[model samples]
Target chain A: MKRLTRSAQRALDRYLHTLRTCLTGSNAIDAHEVEHDVLGHIEQELSECREPIAWARLQIVLDRLGSPLMWVPEHDLPSWKQLLLRLRIGPEDWRLAYASFALWMLAVVALLAAYEPIALGALLGSFVTARAARAFGGELDQSDRSKRWLTEPALATAALVLGGAVLLSVLPAMALVSRELVEIDTLRLQFPSVYHISQRLVAVFERPVSWGWIRSALLHGGPWLLLPLGAWWLVLGGIARWRPRWFAITFSPGRPNCAARVGRLLMIAGALVIGTGVAIGLVKTLSIAI
Target chain B: MKPRKDLRPEKWTTQLRKGVLELCVLNVIATGRLYGYEIAKRLSALSEPTVREGTVYPILSRLKQEGLLEATIEASSEGPPRKYFALTAHGRRRLRHMNAAWDLLDDNLKTLRRRTAP
Candidate 1:
């Protein structure tokens, strides 16, 4: 057989990878025998060609064989495998399913670790996964176009709320467990400034504070910020649903409406608030250091 | 008399070709053993809608699994070792039955066509 160029070899590898994916989890045919036969066929074709093998030429041969997914005779597949194919969100949504499952697993791990940052991120990840799944499912379920808009957003919102609730409930237990395992003195020594800040804040409030209390306060307080944002999103969604014309006019290019103007003003106000807060916090820290 | 028309001739021919492809593969290997590439080449050369090399392998694999075909790996001078396939005794018996069925079907269809011809 004529030697394959570097690019041609890569193309062949990709073609084989697709074939492997199609063959995996399939019980109707012996994957090994089919794979070997395919390789042999490619080699024979290359040998017959007078020119050196290139990606364009190899692509022509691969395309003639058709898509690997099409090669599997669905009727020959076992009942379980047939069911799996039918249940799949879309023709290529297996990747999304795997991603969603992985994110859920990570959320569990983050909850166990009592890491609020990672846990929150994981909750958002689940929302994204749910949204992606719904989008793909909608594309596949084209017959139900009217229901797609409602169902997908509802599913995504449910995933977000449920995942967040589970994470929140587990967090307090995780903090309590961590507090009992670790010594307060060691924690103060390890994070002196953080301990000092908690102490000062507790003193101002005239209340007792510990590492666990500080962590709980911070973690719980973080999600309160999301409430307003979520409400805003819902408001926008409601407006879009009830008055699409107004929503479109508000967002229309070059000609902004009252809502758009108000939104822009609010955004600017938010940025100013955050900027001022950060600047104040920076100045205070610097003054204390001096 | 008026001749009957196949409204979807292309679709009908496609289904017919797919149904007979396995039988054609059996007939190709009836004379002697041939590798997947060689079998595909012979079929494409002789038939319309050229049999692709990729399409031929799965059929070979299915046949081998069904006990109708057996294969052995032989080292080649050109590149990798090639798998050569041959029909088994059971395969030959099955082929004989398939051929008889094909002949019967073909004869009956022809007779029907003759009666309907203009």
Candidate 2:
């Protein structure tokens, strides 16, 4: 290519960028060849022009090039290519929005028809599409009033799926960090008060800790489960408040403050449960022999 | 900012020009190998607004992709290497068939229009 002045270069770069974008979205085969052809043609046209070609000179050549969007005739395109081209170029980048909604709808239909695998597939697709949509979407797209119908179902599903996994993970994490409190003699010799608290803790749970126990407790731990569940919520809530940004994936990016508030609520609930357990354990341990 | 596609009367003609341009490009290369710029120039001279000069590249690329055309890049004294496009054996066969079909279609259309001429 001939040397182009800054303005000429910018214009050419912008044109090529738009062409690249359209081609990428359309899934056009051998797209680089088309790009190379355009560049070669531009170089040829400017070859005769004086050195340091200006935008004024380059603009004329580009004007004759027409739009890259309509370059491939509709009939020439593969069916999928045509669909993607239409969606990508559609108004307001509605591809992500509508595609998510469509997938979610398909999932619902599949579920209705008792096709669990298909339903799960569609739900997974919806979540993926929604995540991708939100990841790429601009602030305006995020705040659009109509986005609820288009994006919320998948986003909500994603939140529920992810939030449940996080909650379930907390119990095992706590178990890993806390072995059987029955082995309190290790702390008994070092910290007398800590051993006292450990004894009270074991009395409160009335059971040993292990993977099987945790699994059973998860299903039927009853009121005893409240302490662990509260702790789980408390930790999550703290993280949500401290770094609301992290919860952006689990909730709408714009609503991190809501996550913070939810965290605060979780912390308060956690405190109440822990306080109740401590009070109950202290009473029970105090009544027993030393 | 776009070049005017066509006036109302030339709308159909502009649409027809897209398909015709493919055959025209094959015919141009059938003569001998020509670089991208020269082919665009020759086609542009024949049809200005009706057939965009810019469209020739995509048609050339499509034909090349479908094995109808092959390109070789050759260094030029002018500057950057020039991509010289030539019809392949398959391309020559496709062009022959296209030309034959066009002749048949063109003769029938001309005869029908003549019979119905107001």
Candidate 3:
């Protein structure tokens, strides 16, 4: 016989006492039956344990077996299926949050592109910076307190500051670029090659017939574009609250499966190249008639 | 199984719990060489409050892997013959070294705390 330690013996004694209570109780007939079933289950587990049972060790085993809930008729405890479902929680929720973020970004791009292509580009640069902050914020782990920025307001503040700085930097540069592009378009109108190329490209889309129309396009489209982005931000924030690490994994690029991702990128690039080539060829044919 | 997110984390007080196996195995063998269950029970008594399936076996496997312990089959009545663990000379030396280090660490912590006190 493998001698049990005093502590192990004590734990077992407590367990047996609980078991006895469950089985021998004078109350419910069902409780007594359940006790017999529980004893059989416990015996099966103990037999498989292969080692001598100690008091403390026994308690751990019992806990793992889910504390063997008492057979209460009215309690709202989760069923086995529910418990299993809770444990098998998927990353779908995080993926939905990420899709929301991507949509938000597209909305912002639409806004900026309408306001001023250059300013839109600048806003894009800022958005990229904001994204970096979010990535770092998401990487924070619970086991390591020092890394958690949510609890430390200073870290969050720092990230916000950096993101804002990026946005500010991009905006002015975009405005300057847009102004220069407008000025250059005016000066180049008299040059045959420049004018022809510009006219061909310009004709591909519905031209803004007047400068006023251009200004109106910018003003009207700008805020409307940001709506999706705002929604995305809210969705991402919600996801982060639900399961921070999963949210990070869903949004953060440069994930482990980079090779498969590269294949997708290559396919998209090929399609874009083909489309651009066809567009240029069509413009050339249209210009020849002119 | 994933730990419950809502419950308070369990606090293990003693430093020995950090490397409970080496010490516990040594303590168990101090009487006589015994099998896996015997050693696990002894350790569970002193600390662990509970032991379970697959827990002690890993520690035993680790000790054997490190060459501090060796296992051999012994006749038993409960089931199949049991695999008992005994400390090698190397194991005994390691236990001594671990004990010395633990003592040194404990003493330093105490001294530092005492000095820092107001």
TM-scores of all candidate predictions against the true structure: 0.47, 0.48, 0.30
Candidate 3 lDDT score at position A255: 32
**Least lDDT summed over 10 consecutive residues: which range in candidate 2 chain A?**
A136-145
- The worst-scoring run of ten residues by lDDT in candidate 1 chain A lies at A247-256
Model 3 regions lying over 4 Å from their true place: A1-290, B1-16, B50-54
- DockQ for every model, please: 0.42, 0.37, 0.02
lDDT (0 to 1) per candidate: 0.62, 0.74, 0.46
Instruction: By lDDT, rank the candidates, best first.
Output: 2, 1, 3
lDDT of 3: 0.46
Reference-based TM-score, model 3? 0.30
Write out the backbone clash pairs for model 3: A8-A54, A8-A55, A56-B49, A56-B50, A56-B51, A57-B50, A57-B51, A104-A228, A104-A229, A118-A174
Model 2 stretches with alpha carbons more than 4 Å out: A25-29, A78-290, B1-8
Worst 10 residues of 3 chain A by lDDT: A67-76
Candidate 1: residue A144 Cα off by (Å): 30
Residue-wise lDDT of candidate 1 within B70-115, one digit each (tens)? 9998998987898899999999999999999999999999999999
Question: Order of candidates by DockQ, top first?
Answer: 1, 2, 3
Q: Which model, 2 or 3, shows the larger DockQ?
A: 2
Model 1 per-residue lDDT at A105: 64
Model 3 lDDT per residue over A1-290, tens place: 23455555544444544444422322323333333333433454477554666545555556643322222211222355335433422222133234334534554566666755644454444445444434432322232233332222322333355535532343334344444444575557666554443333333223454777444433332322223223433343444444445533433332324324433443454444445445545565677788
